[model samples]
Structure formats: C-alpha cells, structure tokens
Target: MAKSASSVDWLNRVFGDSKYSDLTIECGESTWHVHRVVICAQSPFFDKACSNGFKETSSKLIKLEDDDPTIVREMLRYLYTGDYLEQTKEGEEGSRRSALSTNVHIHTIADKYDIPALGDVAISKFSARAAREWKTEAFAGAIEEMYTSANENKEPMHKAAVAIAAENAKTLLNDDCGQAFRKIAEAVPKFAAELSIEIVNMKEKMPPTFARYRCPNSMRCNKVNMLEGLGQASGSRTCTYCSNQYYVNVWVSKKLDD
Candidate 1:
C-alpha cells in the first residue's frame, strides 16, 4: 500500500499551528468552518447593465472536497491574517511545512479564491525571491493575475501585480505562452526589449511539432484569409461574410485560398 499525500497526521492540521478560531463574515455569502470557509458574490454592475433577463448567483457556503486540502486552506488562512509568515507554528509536523515555498503555494490558492488582499501579500512576499520559485508554482499564479486584469483590472493592486509580472519575465520567460507573455511584458517597457529577446530565444528552442496548436475554444473554426501573394493553396484566401483571408493553414496543397 502507498501512503497518499493525505492520511498523514499533519495533513489535517493547518499550515502552521493555527486553529479553527471562531470567525464571522457578512457580505454576499457567509461560510466558515473548523478549517476553512468561502465567500463569493456576483457583480451587481454586470447584472444591471444587461438587465433584460439577468439573474444573480445566489450566495452559498462552499467547503473543501479534497481530503488533504491544505493548499486552499492555507490561502484562506493567509486571507484571515495578512501575516502568513507570522502564523504560529504547529506541533511535531510544524517543521515539515515551514518554508517560503509553502507561502507561495498559498498565494496561488488565494488568487483562485478571488482574495485580492491575500494575493497582494503573496506577490509582495514572493517578489524578492530568486527566479527558480517564479518559474515553478508561482508562474501559474502570475498568469492568473494577468488574465484577471485583462478582463477588468482597475486599482492599486493591479498596478503592483503588473509591475512584478514585468520584472519577473526576464527570468521566467517561456516560449509556450509567448503571446500572453509579450502582452504582459509590454506593460513594463523599462526592459521590454531585453525581456522580449529572452522570450524569442526560448520559443526558438521548442520542437517544430509544437508549432501547430489545436484550437480548443468552443467557437467555430473557419477559413482564414491567406495573405495576398503568400502563394498558399487557399488562393490568397478571402471571405466576405466572416474573414478577409482563408485559414491558410487548413487549405489543401496546390490550391489557393478562396
């Protein structure tokens, strides 16, 4: 038999020696427990703007489904107190889970839970660390922050996050998401050119087979306009209804777009 990540005595405990201290919340929804709780609400502005037939997501309490749900709990733990570093350590197992790395993971969970205050703390704390940590678990959280801002980023918090993402790109550059990375890099032109160079180098090292990406979105795939004089089988593709060029990549050999 193998021991799951859970099942360990410490798995049931909080990141540190923190307890299920009594807590209260009042807003859209209120949910708290011995270990953790969740609170969320739909944006009223969105609802009112297109009110022809809009409804709000009712407030509801949510709990962890994972047996060893330390990741989420720890983030919530930080949300309760801006001082994750100062949280009192727990018994025998306390030594096992003490590290700046754990705090980084908690930051990710906090971002997932829409806890901005906790996320700011995570970013501020992790910003000073070296590159190794950013490329690992921290990368995902940074990307999440970018995506969140893309939708609607307006505040001092977003400004700080944008700053960190740009600064870290020089060390954290990866080719897989070059487009997204470029967008983030442009935000901080202080070293944009150098950062872009690193991104290009990493992209160049990737295998050619990785070039073609499957379109995963639900939108319908259609002909792309093969650029003029490009000489693709799609015959310099053009479409009046949807696009100006045929999806050149999808066109058959020997024929031009359109």
Candidate 2:
C-alpha cells in the first residue's frame, strides 16, 4: 500500500511537471501541455492521434475545438490520478449542483475522446452528485443538455440522466422546473417515453396504502379494503375505472409472543 501511494504521488508529480510533456492539447482558445504516453495509455483516440505517421505525431499538438478546456484539464487529472477532482463544497447546495453539471460536461468530453473508463468515472461522480441535488433546476438543465448532446453510439449518460429525471419526476415537473421537463420531452422522444414508462412502473410498485389510488384513466378508486387484509407480500389489483391491472407490494409487521 505504501508503495502504491508513493507511485501515485510520483505520477501526480509527473503529470504536473512540464519538463517531460511531449504533446500539447489545444481546446478552444486555451492550451494544455500534457504527456502523450499518459494520455495514450488512457484513451485509444489519443493513442491513434499521437501514433507514428499521423500529423500530430510530427507536430506533437492536437486541437480539440469542440471540448471545453476546463473539462480537458479534469480529464487529464483523472488520467493521471485515477480519480477526478471534486469541486463541490460540503453543505453548500448550490455549489454541489454546479459540480454535478460539471461532471456531466466532463462525461461528454470523455465520450467524445472515446475514453470509456474516463466516461464511467465521470458518470459515477455525476450519479453521486445527482443523488444529492437531483431536484435542483441546475440538475434538470444539466440532464437536458446531456440528453440533447448524446448520440446514438454513446448513450449511457443519457440513460443515467433519464433515470434521475424519472426518479424525481414529481419534484422536477413542478412549477419551477416544469419547462425544463417539457423541453426534454420535446427534444428527446425516446428518453421521454422511457421516463414515462419508469414513472408508471414506479407508481405501480408503490407500497399499498388505505388512501384512494389514482388510475391512469384520470379516475380515483376509493377501495380502502383492497389492501386491508393483504399480508406482507406483493399483490395485484384491477382499477374499476380503466379496468387496468396494477401491482403493489405491502409490508406488515406482526407482534412476536415471548
């Protein structure tokens, strides 16, 4: 463990050192001096771009016109340290939401570069950040961007964003963030359909309660006894209005006699 730690420290130092950097990555108007070996080790796209006979092989410069420089920096950090930097402050909700947005951007950059592992790391961080701030308008907007930018070949981030949106549909569809939800539905029909299906599935899987159940046909069933005698298990019921079947799981505890 100590050796591993020392190795990580050495790699971090090397990553920051400019003395041995052999390649330069230009993003937008900004430039980053980086090691070709380090980047190629993590990304096949870079490996090919930096290989012999390629234009970048002689010039030792690669231009990423579409990627943000800050995201590229984070990608380099992850390549060297095996971990990406987390900029969100603890106990600060706004900063945390911003961090989630940044993670999604980083994921996009990783996907663009064909670095699947880096994309996976970014998605993991994004998921953690979303768990903390999924109801925020910032997060909803980030999901919109993610779904919009995602292509057919790369869609894990889109799927993850849809899952987050579906899980928080009630809060996200409220007055404050309703427009963002509408935009997502309009821009990405497949994602919208998946979210709707997930919402219905979630409602069907909700635990049984005495409160009246709302049917898909816009009618309410006030059958309180439908769940009264059911024990701690899953069961199905048919809505009287739509005649559609729904499933519910109930957990009831029984007193133990000593």
Q: How accurate locally, in lDDT, is each candidate?
A: 0.41, 0.70
lDDT of 2 at 29: 72
Lowest lDDT sum, 10 consecutive residues, model 2, at: 249-258
The local distance difference test score of model 2 is: 0.70
Tens digits of per-residue lDDT, candidate 1, 1-258, equal: 222445433433533333553222222232334222312222122233224443222322233343124444455444333345512366532344434444445455554445666656665665554233444444444544433433232333334434554556654465554455555555645345544554566556644321222222216544333333332234344443354343545333323323
Q: Least accurate stretch of 10 residues (summed lDDT) in model 1? A: 209-218
Instruction: Give per-residue CA lDDT, model 2, range 36-126, as digits (tens).
Output: 8778977889999998689999999999887666677778888877777656466733344467778777777777778778778878888
Model 2 ranges off by over 4 Å: 1-3, 86-97, 150-153, 174-183, 186-188, 203-258
Best by lDDT: 2
lDDT of 1: 0.41
